[model samples]
Target: MRWHKRLLAAGAVAVVALTSAACGGGKVRGAEDSPQPGTSLSAADATFTYVPNLDVVTDWDPASSYSNEIIAMENVYESLTRYNPQTKKAEPRLATSWTSTPDGKSWTFTLRSGVKFHTGKPLDAAAAKAAIERTIEVNQGAAYIWGAVDKIEAKDATTLVFTLKYPTALDLVASAGYASYIYDTTATTDDLNKWFNAGHDAGSGPYTIDSWQKGQETELTLKKFDDYWGGWSGQHYSKIAFRVTPELTTAWQLLQRGEVSFVQRLNSQLFAQASTTPSVQTSQTPSFQNLLALFNTQSGPLKDVRLRQAVQKAIDYDGLIAAIKGSGVAASGLVPGGLLGNTPGMTPKQDLPGAEALLKEAGYGPGGKQLDLTMTYAQGDSDQDLFVTLLTSALDKLNVKLTAKPLQWTTQWDQGKSKDESKRQDIFIMYWYPDYADAYSWFVNVFHSAEPISFNLSYLKDDAIDKEIDSLPELTAIDQPGAEKAYADLQNKIINEQAAVSALFVQNYQRAYAKSVEGYVDNPAYPNVVFVYDLKPGA
Candidate 1:
């Protein structure tokens, strides 16, 4: 995941804006006696090691940590509710139960007692209220997820109520993995963010920070919290370690050598190998994530609709999918599969002739002036590299000159939002996943006209689109079919009618784990996140 920081003004209400940032089968190991709760065990059997294919912690502030650190943050922090894709419902976590008014404008929650943060402070409605207020006050990351809130009241020690300005799904909002975290609001540090960034944690989850080494192979390590409300009674790893391995092959080799218990992801070829290996297990779960190519509609040659459409037509969707060995499916629209607003049977196909004709009409082709364009994607992303390669090959037929460059995530995002229009890349490639499982995440962040320019890399400002996106939240809560139709119309207008962006494909979340690890499950709602607490050492 790639993300950056954005400052929100005092009184402006905008929809959610991002910073821009599985099943398995395998042979069982020899049965062994499982470790009981609070029992000591050896390092080999008690530790669960994970390897991530990139540098891990981009942000440390729980309210604003929206990047790859989510893999760790999810383990350290607890939210009021958690989305359970298996049951298609929001299950209880920090809160025991919740209810909403008939009009959906107000919600009340009953907090679970006997819970305590790492600081030994009791978890109560007042603490939860304070944590949420802090997030909303900072107004970074996905704080906009609470845009509908009119007010929040800590009615009692265990009761919290939320009054909304409009009808909204506050349950889904509370279940978000980003800014929805409930932490210790009574931190003694003058700056809570600085304290958190100094490798300290204030969460009440099942784990506590044991150690952190920046720019080292061992990025983070967490130990079990014996004081956790959810008592550790079953077989669970006592220690969790995350190591940064930039190369997928290196991670695979580590797994083969039994140096790590899990590999977050593997390349297609490596995944195929792991799938057949007798000692390894693999999972392939469809995700809410997708790749999007944002044309510089506000600047450069791509400003022309004809040129944008021509480039869209030149993309070989099937070729790109093949390049990844079917690890991903061609996107039907802006929304990915298994999400709302996704239009079935609408996958795009390359039209070389149509592209050439459009290029000619734009006065850029073999018979006209050559069009030169520049594209920027995250460095070290092999899939995006292949995407650029295939797209470059296709555009060569139309005599378009493409210069593709890879940059660090922060640098790439900064350049895309540069004040000087001429300095921005003509095409910005990025991966998008929802803050929550909602279509509003797409329209509000990427397509709804950027004012101070958040994640709308396209720099578009269409009032019609903005108005429609604004109505979606209310419509979605009140009327389901109407919201669906509105989302469909928005997708068609943006992708097919206006050629606003080039949506490439939706990828499947891939994972490989050692046969000894048990109770592994993948959820699309939180991509690239593993819930190690739910796992235990197999017998």
Candidate 2:
């Protein structure tokens, strides 16, 4: 989850006019018109159009924003560092290089020279400091990532230093997708927040917001920044448009007709069809996104750990995976594949008899009183709908009455965090992804103890679990082997020993793009995003 803003409404209007003639069976370059790979093309001939499955922008603010708008924000904002999943390291973005004290309490960063924000303000240590301070002050989004930060000092125009309260991995925290954007602090008006939401930007990114229509045509449009530090000498798109197409069928049809350059997601049936099409190129990669079936441990029949374990074992995981149409696999643990703390072959196979035995022991089977339970998931998710269908049939075997309700994200979350324990659903199902590529996101946010209740819908508070989670960041930064061992112990405790929640399948990031689009690569670190700067027109 993340967010964004727009600029130059007139320019956006002009781009919309151009998009009308360029997209939706417009002047799309055919095989004959496409240039060979690496061949340079002018801006007029290199426009990129993307169709997201839904309205991608939820919050307009960069700081304190945690939503789908990261797809747009990633292109419009820049961070101090960018995490490279392939290398499992932090790479330079705004800051060219950095160094930390041996104890990891003090660090210094060297800013890249000659960069300017879209508002014509020079990027320096002072600017970066002010921007970070603003985010910390607002404390809306993922501000918790900076909990270890004690003080930040602008040592000079080109140098910045950070002192920490403890030995922490500041590098990874600085690369977070949310609350880590470096923007211009200087605003022309006193009401900066109002100015931002009114469609303005101040980041030094490759693209600038050209226009935005909240629920109208071409939801968002971005144009190339002429003064981008990366420089537009290579094959780069001049314009990028994001259209909200809720139906997968409409998006797939548009992709086939070369009306749009890329489609964000497609159903399994459509994905299999796209694989064989000559006009579309499909990519499938492992991702950090995983489905979580959170148990309401604070109240109800599920309060018993045995019942929770019985419920987990009662589900047909294999059938659930097949329902997603090969888009994912049974998750091994809370953390997904390609990230730290994931253990292969750790997931237990479904045992129907075992589940029945546990249910009977808990007085909820044919030999005992029947059990009735309720669950909730986000509406319009086909995969989740399939999960509920299969789960209903499986739970019937245990003489349980399971009621599944689908609601909008806001409604679902509101009910999950309901103050009255009796009013909450027995189970709350949702997808969980990281603000950054760290296992800590899963450990600290979802499982840790929450008083007012944030994302920890499970509502289980174990002191041992809390201690392990709180120690993970520093332990991970200092000792890889120790961290791995600690994660393994915790997984076994939470899933096998305690049965706090059900770990479902991890998503396979899939996308279908027109053949004319080239230089496409899937990075799970930046989920649901395509860097327009790296893409070019191709034969």
Candidate 3:
């Protein structure tokens, strides 16, 4: 568990597979048949209710599914070496032990024994290979995580070896992170599209999707595995239902009335109310999500670095905080604050005069033509609307006209698609939730020059920064102080020298739960998201 900022700056977000299997069931009966006046229901038939942020989860395929928000992962699936949120370390889960060559290219993993899938099949090295290969074959949203994968072989039934095309820690951590959950290969079908979409997911975890209706609700039912090789992470519930409530008011009411047992996030007002409610309890975790206003560096007036810098400085981050009226504060860097490699001392400052000066240097102020920039924000989001109003007032001072465009999330995604000036975004407000708890997940995917326009919305490239980013893994491998220094240099370059981004505050996700629910662990590694495996009914 290397929690040190320097060495852990480069984390693993491999798009590989890590499977979990278990033993027989162990159910303990409770006093009441149903829940008492103020207690949890019987463990055997327990049910927890929730209001999910999403209307529906379109895909259940681990290889292709791309969701940055709350997702149902641990209960139904498992990974090789997951980042223990509590320890901030990549600890064993599916794969027991691992070793890498001196070159760091070839790595071997020892599989856990006697772990059988719910499909009555044993997960072996071959299953591990198939999981990695299928993810590559789908070539969907998550394929970028496995770009460096050169070769994979099952040396034996219990031994899995992975070889990388280039030397980086990505491959080593790939099998333990994001797209790394292993499926029961024995029950899988060749037609991946039909297989995943048809709900024939051969995962080997504690729970399975009992039923789901599009745009309605997803009901997950659990059955304990008596033969589980590695025991469950925490308390487990028998049933959980996730329903979508688009309105915050409706979701809040549902939680207070006991219709829903828990909610993943709450508004500031709702959070205040929950703390005072008699039948409710509240908890919060500072979200690791990096919200930013991404500027398209490839096109439009922003192509000039000076203009970009001016725009960055023109927006008053402090003003944004005052307007929002919440627990949030200014961001340090692209990586989340309160976490390793955040570079806490560095705060994004508003340089009004400097902004005007930079703009004039780029011929964007004074006697220049009127500058009208289109900034997109989520429609129906009151907080965003308020922020935009403040933004417009600020930009008005510089004689820069700021046009606010309110859009739905799907439409925003459609707009994010290209270098085509027609489709490229000028300034789209968005957030980057790391695939894993690592600085590389943010720096590489969001800011890397090597990434495609889809991944790197900034469409920026710096040879100097690129060279430093490339050497991060080796730097960390060599020594801690040197790695920290290297990361600091890059963080400074990206935030100050490049002036490629204007960061927003780190979010603090507030969750509300019914009085009967307990043992809910808010893993900051996954931000505000929750999995039923870590939560169970309580008195």
Q: Residue-wise lDDT of candidate 3 within 259-357, one digit each (tens)?
A: 777777677788888889998888877767656777877788877778788888887788877766564667887767644567767777788899888
Taking the candidates one at a time, how many backbone clashes does each contain? Answer: 4, 4, 15
* Candidate with best lDDT: 1
lDDT of each: 0.81, 0.79, 0.64
Worst window of 10 by summed lDDT in candidate 3: 1-10
Lowest summed lDDT across 10 adjacent residues in model 2 is found at 5-14
Task: Give the per-residue lDDT digits (tens) of candidate 1, residues 289-370.
Answer: 8889988888899889899999999999999999998578888888887666778766889999999999998889878999
User: Model 2: per-residue lDDT, tens digit, 1-539?
Assistant: 21111101000111112121121112333334432323322335676888886665555567765666678888988999999988988899999999998888898999999998988889999999999888888877787888888899999998999998887778888899888989887854566665566567788889888766555536777788889999989677888878777788988887777678888889999999999999899999888888888888889999998899898998788888978987878789888877778777677578889989999888887678889999988677888888899889998878988999987666677688889988898988877788788888888888899878877888979999999988888787777788888888888888887787787788887799988888888878777889888888776
Cα misplacement distance, residue 330 of candidate 3 (Å): 2.3
Clashes of 2: 4
lDDT of 1: 0.81
**Model 1: residues with Cα > 4 Å off, grouped in runs:** 5-44
